[model samples]
Every structure is written in structure tokens, then in C-alpha cells.
Target: MRKIFTTIVAGLLFAVPFTAMAQVNILACEPEWAALAEEIGGPKISAFSATHARQDPHHIRARPSLIAKARRADLIICSGAGLEVGWLPILLQKSGPQVQPNALGHVTASHYVPLLDTGAGVDRSMGDVHPEGNPHIHLNPHHILPIAAQITDRLAQLDSANADYYQNRYQDFAQRWQQALAQWEAKAAPLKGTQVVVHHKSFSYLIDWLQLRAIASLEPKPGIPPTSSHLESLLQQLKATPAKLILRTPYEPEAASLWLSSKTNIPALVLPYTIGGVAEAGDLFALYDATLALLLENANVE
Candidate 1:
């Protein structure tokens, strides 16, 4: 009887440490935020992204599996400013109070960054224009540290015991990220003032950061699919000004950009707009590396 008692107590002691190591659950609205959370939270958190590289953040459906994840989430991270307007509200409604809007557990990356394309004259006629500005803020590497700071604060608040761990992680990530940013800027020097056309405004932040000029978009308006008439107009416009390259995300249909490229002799390139968008862009640093390499390869620098 004493031997049996000793064995049971030993088993219970062994299980205690595993139970104590339970991770905080994070439901990130996009893959970039999930990757960012992983950087800050390290092994103390389990981060999951609702949208993948090929999925359009603007149009995701709030499916039942997502609702299940939301219910279990200790925190939620997203790029706000109406980027996830289609489904985030529904997820918030079904999620715990901790992750509701304005809650400490709810972190919006855009709220911490200076947004573009804001102000009056926004209407449905504008075709999916975000009144709060462009939410593709992750494309600008400079915007990352601020958002990482915010995330670290939230992680500390959520799990005070691991606060120092998160802070140390953020500091290390910041140092490496800053070094990468400088290198990227130096390598991209030749791309400044280089004119290009785009399938959409998806890379506005990237273009703005690199000082590249966007001559035209395949789409006539935001979120609108390209039409024959609009493409013909863009063809005429480019004939006069002559853009160096045409850009599009992996998820975007290639028809419009390809058609334009065939006529103009300008190369159409697909940029991995987020983490996992391309095989090479497996992480945040790699995302910028791949982007700059692609631009430099095709750029007509003097």
C-alpha cells in the first residue's frame, strides 16, 4: 500500500511542471501579426493567424472554426483601420470579453502607427476605401518597432510572470530588425524615384518607404477588378510616361498585369506581400529581403 501511494505522488509531481508551462493563446487577424507575436511572446504564447498569405484580408469569412479559436483566445492582434471590416466584428462578438474592442487584450497595430489615406470624401462609391487609412502598415519596416513595443506591453500585462522574457525578446528583435532596415535602405538606394505600375494599392507603404514612384494601378479604383477599358487607358498613360515594372501580390489575378506587360514590354512581378506569401519570405526579415532583391533585379537604375 505504501509503495502504491509513493508511485501516485511521484506521477502527480511530474505533471505539475507541464501544467504550469501552459501557453497564452493568441489569435492574430493576419500572418504578419502572428509572426510578430511569435517574436515578442516567444514560447510563452501560442500564436495563430486567421488569414494566410494567399487569402485576402479584406474579404475573409468569419467561419465556425475561427469562432472556436476566438472563444479560446487570451488576446487578439490585428491591423485595424477597416482592413478586417468584413469578419473581425463577428469574431469579436463571439470572443471572450478580454479580446473585445478597447479591451487590454485587443491590440491593433495600425493604432500605434501613422496611417495614410485618411480624411473626408470617403464613400462606398470609392470601392473599399478605408476611411481610417491604409492598413497595410507592416510593409514599412520602420513601423514595426512601435508595434512590437505595444505587443510586449500587452504580453507583459497578460502574463506578468513572463514580462521580462517578452521585453528581452523585443529588445533582441529590435536590434536585429534595425540592422536589417539599414541594409535594406542602402541596397534599395538605386530603386528610389524608379517608376512602376501596380495591380492595386497593396504595396503603397513599401513604395513610400523605398521612395519608388507608382505611376499607375491596373484597377481604375480601389478593390475594383481591372477592366479592358481601364487597361487600355493605362496602356496609353504608360506609353507617354513609361513605367519600369508592374507589381502585383500573389493572390491577385495575373491577367491584367500580364496583358499590360505583353504590350508595354515591362516585366510584371509578384511580391510576397506578407510572411509565407512566398517560400523565401518565411519570416519577417526574409519578407523585406525578398522584396528588395526582386525590385533590385528588375529596377532600371542608371
Candidate 2:
């Protein structure tokens, strides 16, 4: 019995080193990307989110701590298309890691999904606009299916020995995710044609999914904050449309939404915007599930 106990203890000690050596490090720019990384990576990944789910990605500070995390990453993922335009370049410069475009550590999930609002024109006069398009594709669950697959492929490239593991997990996740997306679409279908004024261009994918038209915005342009005149003008146009919903993210100012909601009776929905943005949206699937319910509920409320 004494020899058997000693053997068991020795075996446990041997396993600990193996587990520590086998893990992959992931550094994601946002929570949505971090959540996706966790899904595909399972227990073999250590993922870090540069910004919280509730913060606006456009305004994040490229602090020293985030750069330190990036330097140690085996893989770094981000929502490209100018979503992280404000801080990504600074991270690259400060981390000082030469991650080439084709390197294993460099991955952008945006390439996996089809982008919306690509046709929107950009000019400084129109405020801070993404020259590529709206970078908030994660708002719509339909886009997540493809994005997951892309990340799976990326993980395989970075850690070829674990390629099969990533692929298996991706296939399983895709099946479940597709079912969730289907339910959301069906639930939100009734909201089709609901005119909404988005605080930013963040919900272009959601607007496309629900067939909701963006009549105007609280922000005069893409990245600029709303002016008094802009809000006043939008209020006038939307006052008569009682059913029109105003979509705003968790980080956006509630003052404008509150004012419009009071004046025009439009319920300003402070949505999760991304997974983990709110306590209710604890995971990737819950974020969309919650958002769809809110938008649909408000559509019928008036």
C-alpha cells in the first residue's frame, strides 16, 4: 500500500508539468473575440481580453499592461475593419513583436464573416467613420458561425499538433450556435421593418438581420458624439413613428437616449452590444439571445 501511494503521487506530479507546457496563450482585443477563443481552445488556452465587454472599443486606451499581455501571446485575435483602429496600432508598436501578416500569432476574425455596411461612405466631415465598413458584426449571431470556423483554422495553424482538437470543437460549437441563431431570427422576425436610430454604426448586422431600417442616429456621423442640434433634428423626424426603436450600446450615453425616449416615447434600448458587456450576457450565445428579446419586446411595447 505504501509503494502504491508513492507511485500515485509521483504520477500526479509528472502530469502537472505536462499540463503547464501544453497550454496556448491567446490575447484578444475584445471580449467577443476572447469568448470565441475560449470556445475553440477549451482547456488548452489562456485567453486575455484587452478591453472589457462594456467598454467601447473605439475609445480604449492602449495601456502598458495590455502591451505586456500581447508580448507573451502565442496567438492574438481582434475584430478588425477598424473596430480596434484606435488602440491596435499602438499595441503593435509597443509589444514590439514582429507578427507578420501571415504569421501564426497574427489573426483577425473579421475575414471569416461577411461584412455589412461596406457601402457606407466615409469622410472626416461625417465624423469618425470606418473606411472599410461597420465593424460590429458580432452583434448578429449569424456572423459568428463563420468567424468560429476561421478561428478554428487559425488555431490549427498556430498549433498544428492540436489541429484536430480545434476542428472537433469548432464543429460541435457550430452546430449549437446555428440552432441558437435560428431561434433568434425567428423570434426577431416579427420586428422586421422597425425603424431604429442606432447610437453608432455598431448594430449594422442586427439591423440587417431584423430587417430594421436605420432612419437616423443620435450621433451625427459614424464616430462623433451627438450634438444638441443633431439630437433635436432626429427627435423631430422620429416623433411621429411611435414604434420606432432606438438601439444603443451599453457604453453609450443614456442622456440622449433618455431624452428621446421621454420626448418621442421611443424606448432607448441599452443593449449588450457584445458578449459579457452586461451581467445578463455572460457568454457568446446569451448576448444575442438577450439583444433579440429586448429589441422584439420594445417593438411590440408601443
Candidate with the greatest TM-score versus the true structure: 1
Each model's C-alpha lDDT?
Answer: 0.89, 0.79
lDDT of 1: 0.89
TM-score of each: 0.92, 0.88
Least accurate stretch of 10 residues (summed lDDT) in model 1?
13-22
- What's the lDDT of the predicted structure labeled candidate 2? 0.79
Distance (Å) between predicted and true CA of 146, model 2? 1.8
lDDT of 2 at 61: 93
Tens digits of lDDT, candidate 1, 1-302: 99999999999887554323368899999999999999998888999999999998888899999999999998899999889988999988877788997898899999998987676787656785566678889999999999999999998888876778889999999999999999999999989999999998889899999999998999877688999999999999999999999999888889999999999999999999999988999889999999998888887674
- Tens-place lDDT per residue, model 2, 129-210, is 6677777778777778777877788777767768889999999999898888778777777788887888888888878877
Q: Choose the strongest candidate by lDDT.
A: 1
